[model samples]
Target: MMRYIGSKAATLPAIQSIIETHASGATSLCDPFAGICTVARHFKRLGMRVETGDLLWGSYMFQLATIALNEMPTFDRLTPTLELEASNESCAAILSAAQKVLAWLERSPGRPGFVTAGFSDAEGSGRRFFTQENAARIDAVRVQIAKWRDDGLIDMLEEAYLLACLLDAADRVANTAGTYMAHLKSWSRKALKPLQLRAIPIVNNHAQNCCSRTDARETAKTNVDVLYLDPPYNTRDYSFYYHLPETLVLWDGATPTGKSGVPATRRHQISDFCVRRRASSALDELLGQSSAKFVVIHYAADGLIRHDEILDMLNGRGKAQFADLKVRSYNSRVREADIKAHHRIYWCDSH
Candidate 1:
């Protein structure tokens, strides 16, 4: 099953192999920072109970949808209704809203101006690329979806999946760079561009699973056989990188406040991921509270977290051994480039 959470999902087979080698009868697996629930879903497929936690709302939704599959309402029955009414309403509302925003942008000055912007010259009088009209339509659909969710017509998981789909679709039509922070240098001279949204089947065959939205450091006391730690490598807060989509889905129409209140610029910011003094304390707290028999932490060589420091912290708590693996080359949307030779996958075991 495709999971919306977890990085280094490509490395899961190796991680699973190690788990099989060390703990054959492990009844449960937990991922503290389960992004897309990739690891949790893999274990769930093998009949092991899975528990996941993430502070981010979107990540929490992904974990709940992926791991808590048993609780989901049957998609077969719901799909037709969703497709005809909810999905259409949502898409239409998004489009309407986006068009409204685009019109506002045309009248606005500075970078927000559209009539005088370079994008005005795209094929088909800019509709071939992206028109203020399309943007409003996208926003209109999203607004409708939000309203439906608020009215209890859709559950959280369903709403989440729908929002994810909309986000993916909007990304295709967005006249911005790969991320929403930057405008596209050239607009697409096309209409009804390709939409790429991952759809979750209404009928999920995966085993029963559950997820919680809480701090990992606090949730480690549950009884489990394996505790998997994949904390943020440096301080790259996912909130900022994916804020555009989040803002759209989670938008209350309230003005943003402080630093996070404003939209980010094209230039990437790296301040959050930098090593901080509190990092050690947080790690120690998590290690101390985990009720699992063994702990496996995934770390990267280029992160603010030092391998020696992590090893020392784990060793101080219980019996520990460290294993390392090289990460395959991968492109990062936030980093906007391919990371060369990023050494990753640290397996720290506590027996």
Candidate 2:
């Protein structure tokens, strides 16, 4: 339910096949631009140690829940506080406790707060990112999460998991397309549905996975057998596309501005890869910093730095090969014909 602009879910099978064919001996992988941690989650299930980093706080939360945590959080301290019944099966007990918390949150009455005041049409804000009721619910849940963290009721992993749940739930009812660049003038069918928080499946790979908030250039240097890079494809800034989730996680109460109702501070989260002039240079810098024995990169054929240029760059590091995965083009203007595009994956063993 966590929508993304360039999710690799569809291309994951092909990428994994290519990696297993070429770099089967790899024991660890790092995804510096781990949007939603989809790639990291797959590789983690394959018994590879994972490291993930991203500029967006929401991405970091997903990584924390899906990659970094090796077991379900027991919520041992909070269990007694909630007066929940104990179970002989530890894992089941913990998961049930988490679900109970989520159910309680869902039952809480909605309250108009920061999110409703800024991101909803309530009080004539004019923005329609979410309905007034949903916005108030979002506000109430978000505030409760912060309160839990402050009251020592949840740890970092627990906090991230809850926030990830909220992010996914909120996205389902949002009035935007895949991205939050703009909202529909009229309410969409999906947006009319009530928000429901659900628990995510926590991965237990038994490997020490690391996640952090850092630039790709910096995290690429981490020692790993394989490094996966999925940078921004075009000039569209992800900060703008995903500002709602970013703001929701930070909960800084920053004033929203412009037609999109994004906070002005979101400008700081823009990446160099979104700038045409700096895109190529950013890739080069990240490649140079990476210490991984194998490097796998995903880029669009018509991305800011063309796929040919990306191949050439990879070849310079070592022997390189590529696979072109066909993707359905999302251009609504060209409805007369089925347009398609290629998402190219380049993998190489570093010299």
Candidate 3:
């Protein structure tokens, strides 16, 4: 769930309330946004069938590794030998690659400069969040992981798990705030620390779950008991925020261009799905296609989609009810001061 954007951890109580109110015996849950698969994971733990899907590659990795662990291999089964060894040849190669990339980035124009990047606080040193050496090490690890995948030494599930862990570690050591576009006001000049990676243990089993990469509206055929809609709220696009990590995972050294081309792939553009007019059409399509008894749409007050508009849209179609769940969100990545606000969660039921 740590990797998903717009996690519903804050709205779980409300979500659960809606589920309890509407769900009958043996229910299945669907979260269209499905960032990090948190909602799907929660429902899975409760012995409910869960189906999660997201557009982002990283989001897919999170779901495959954490949420859809039923068919995944155990951590013990993945034994390709990756550990911190001062004399290991693989480690040496990784360190070397990182240094090269760092050197190249130093010449590029960007915030936080290359010399002062990393996740630690040793202020006053000209080092960056990632040392040239550390960057090389990470690059090397990525290479080895890819090799393992190609050789069938590891399955796609294991590869995604390892990649996610690496990304998590890199995120911690990065000098930027939570996002890559912006750096932290206070710079940290400490040497890059080693990243500890762990895989979630899989438990329980159910019928093989199904997933699709198609748009939410297109995927809604026959809804179950509960339908959880958690779309992006504010204009703060997720692709921009997590660009660095994405580059590392999906980096082909394509020479980034425009807002989405270079280091950050502007793949998850908010404009594509954030407009109010589009929301109405999408919602109507979703409701029209869904056969569920209850619909729960999680929205924010600060979003481009208004609560009144959402209620009106839902009200026009069925016997819907709206409940505002006050949620406090703290944005560590926002350029401005940490954002603290109350968001409304709308629960609409159609009998």
Q: Considering every candidate listed, which one attains the maximal lDDT?
A: 2
What ranges in model 3 sit over 4 Å off? 1-5, 24-26, 75-133, 188-192, 203-205, 256-271, 330-338
lDDT of 2 by residue, 97-140 (tens): 67777767888899999989888898888889999999999999
C-alpha lDDT score of every prediction, in listed order: 0.57, 0.85, 0.59
TM-score of each: 0.70, 0.92, 0.75
As a whole number from 0 to 100, the lDDT of residue 255 in candidate 1 is 38
lDDT of 3 by residue, 153-202 (tens): 67776777767666765666665544555445554543345433343444
Q: Which stretches of candidate 1 lie over 4 Å from their true place?
A: 1-6, 75-134, 171-184, 187-192, 196-198, 201-208, 254-275, 328-338
The count of residue-pair clashes in candidate 1 stands at 35
Question: What is candidate 1's lDDT per residue for 168-192, written digit by digit as tens?
Answer: 5555666543433334445554324
Question: How displaced is residue 290 in candidate 2, in Å?
Answer: 1.3
lDDT of 3: 0.59
Give the worst 10-residue stretch by lDDT in candidate 3: 113-122
Error (Å) of candidate 1 at residue 122 is: 13
Angstrom error of the Cα, residue 123, model 2: value is 0.5
Clashes of each: 35, 0, 19
Model 2 error, position 143 (Å):
0.5
